[model samples]
Target: MESTAKQDPTAFKRIEFLVVTKNAELLSVSKDLVEHYKFRAEYSDSVDTVDADTRLSSSPMMILISLEEIEGLQERMKNLQQLRAAFPRSHIVAMVAGDESTDDCEMLRGSGARYLVLLQEIKNSSKLYYLAALLVQGTYIPVPVSDLFPSTQVNFNAYHKLVLNQKFLPVIFSGFTFSDKKYRQLETAQQVYVRREELGEYRKYIETYHDQVGAALKKRCRVMMMSLMALYSEILLLLSLDCEAGKKDLVQSKVSEFVQGSQDLGRYLKDCPDVWNVIAKALDFQFCRYERGPYILAYAVYISLKADWGQMQDVVMTALLADLGILDLTPESFKTLQKKNEKHLKPEELERYRHHPMNSLNRVMLRELEVSNETKSSIVCTHERNDLKGFPNQSPADKIPAEAQLIHFCELLDRRVRASLEDGILTHDFVRKQVWEEEKDSLKRFNAAFLDKIEKVLVA
Candidate 1:
């Protein structure tokens, strides 16, 4: 038989946070911490609060010990071992100050600390409580704790130095949701997929122009573009190697970051024409190096024309990565690789040329970027036409994603512009008439709505 008197379960079942710090003021949870984690916290200078009390033992407990504030470091570490022995289930989070040495970080781990965090960096950090929860669940972090939390600090900004520049790479690589195994797979995948010389040449060209641009916004945008190239190049390269199976989350994470980076840059791109010009021109020249000149030209269509910011991002990424497989194919005789079936080529060669859509699809779908289904479809449907004459999987009208139609129009515009340029048609008026004619004629093949929108944006 059981006896109960109007039970209040949550009163006894609250999550407890034990913070060991000399300064109660510093230990007090910030608004971000409070709002994100609703744990009932207790502040104390000693680690004795980690005892197996009835309530704490029944619920989850996180004991955050500040190494900087505590005295007699050796004795404190000895006490930490005893405390861990006492409460075998609790997470012992060693909170060191930012200026601590790397050896100190290793020492904390050796002293039975499951988690090591810098208290100075934890004010409003999103990853703090996340690591806390993972530690409690016995998460396996593949890298050393020191790698996750690098030591020392700097403020090397022009005015007061930039805040984000210091921890940029650490924050980026560490904040992702992949496990250690998956991260290694991703790194290895990039190594195998990217052709070293081509990627190196592209990176060098971009780096040179980016340095020449000399604007902070342009430099940032260049980073995003470089990252985009690295990502797409790897995705395609991985597909060519037949090693991208079962790494969905890893691939999706990169794609998600790429999209996020593109969207983030859209904010700076809104009213800054000079900044946009620098970035677009750099992308154009870089793509020209690899014979995918249409790649960036398609992207420039979005900036040169008026379109929705969201739609602009969709088209920009679609245009950038649609022909990713072309990186592997050295198109020496590759005049007009855009068309589904080139009349000048033999049947088998044309078939091989047409295989790029499949290669593009294979690379993109398996690697799984957190892009829209429409975006993925746009990539595969790169060769599709409104006349119902596309190859592989001739997606009829209305079957294609909206962005595919947008990309189709842009691809056509870029191809025609290139044709005019290569033909030595130097007059600006001739090229403008050429673009305007193509845009007007493309209403049937590409969607009419995008044509109408970009037609207004087309300047001679």
Candidate 2:
């Protein structure tokens, strides 16, 4: 039996969530479930009341609405759309009757709902509340691998017989998975697989819930590492599946998010000191995982400098596409450059390598990306020096962008660190000495103002 008493209005004070439904039973259950998960929520009898409540100081972080009415499903969906328009950042969960048509589920998804919860299942199962908690918090939780997926030993027929519900399970961290042992960290990307599924299912999941999925996956990774993974995976896709227009759009969208996230992280890290070492260690791990050492090095320094949002965006775009020209090189030429030693390259190889910045700019243009003029300049001038002694074009000191100057210094530092690592030197000590002691004079190759910013970050 469910309580029918109206929840006291005073209970809504300081609440961070709202549950909207005409059913008194659902109101009682939802209130209990949310409070059980340590979230305070207020109940509303209808979406109309929620619309009025939006004028309050703090909007709810999540809105759970019941859409089980077959007679007025369309009206309920319109209410959902209105709520979505009003609270764009709120996580909208639409509760259905589990046995609804696929078309109805799709409509619910299309109506701006971030999650679809079966009403009967929620009422009967304790475990489903945990899932609801995850949806509301947008946080990661490690679950047994078997709980989230069909048995790895299952045959084709047996696997097919399993429900498609597993596809909706948010079980992975980017390309990797965890061991079933209690809350273990990620082991390897190779250990996970979902076999013989139609691509449509994957696409549908990505379209509807990719952002929330990524948010839930952010446990060990902060913004920089996430941005690196996004760029790395999308670039791999672009390289392999160049014909996929949808992938290209995804890449562009991810780049924009990366910029926005970087801005947010920059503000957060500005007040913290001596935290860069920990961040560097995490970045080094990502570098090893993604095989993107230069990007990691540039990113580590880039975030530390705490550039304005506009400059950060331009520099990040440059860092991502600066080396894309290496993709155009022959395998042998690419391998030569991968050594991070230009002296080893033959004259022809060296010439081609020098022209890679221009090639990268050309690649960006060919991709039809909507980058700003500043970003274009940064990519082309990434290798140019303020001393007027660098690059294929030998662009003058005044011609270089400040964003390009920072990237150039980081690239130079990355090569130095890699060379020292090859000689069995510790990276941390080498970087400290190289930046503060040996590179004091070399810093003149960058703009004085830009170098001052780097100096402050290093000393801090």
Return the TM-score for each candidate structure. 0.44, 0.49
Query: Per-residue CA lDDT of candidate 1, range 282-318, in tens?
Result: 3333233333423353354444344642265566567
Residue pairs clashing, model 2: none
Candidate 2, residues 410-459, lDDT tens digits: the string is: 66665555556557767655475566444466644676666655665554
lDDT against true structure, model 2: 0.53
Distance (Å) between predicted and true CA of 275, model 2?
3.4
Report clash pairs, candidate 1: 157-161, 157-162, 252-368
Evaluate model 1: give its lDDT.
0.48
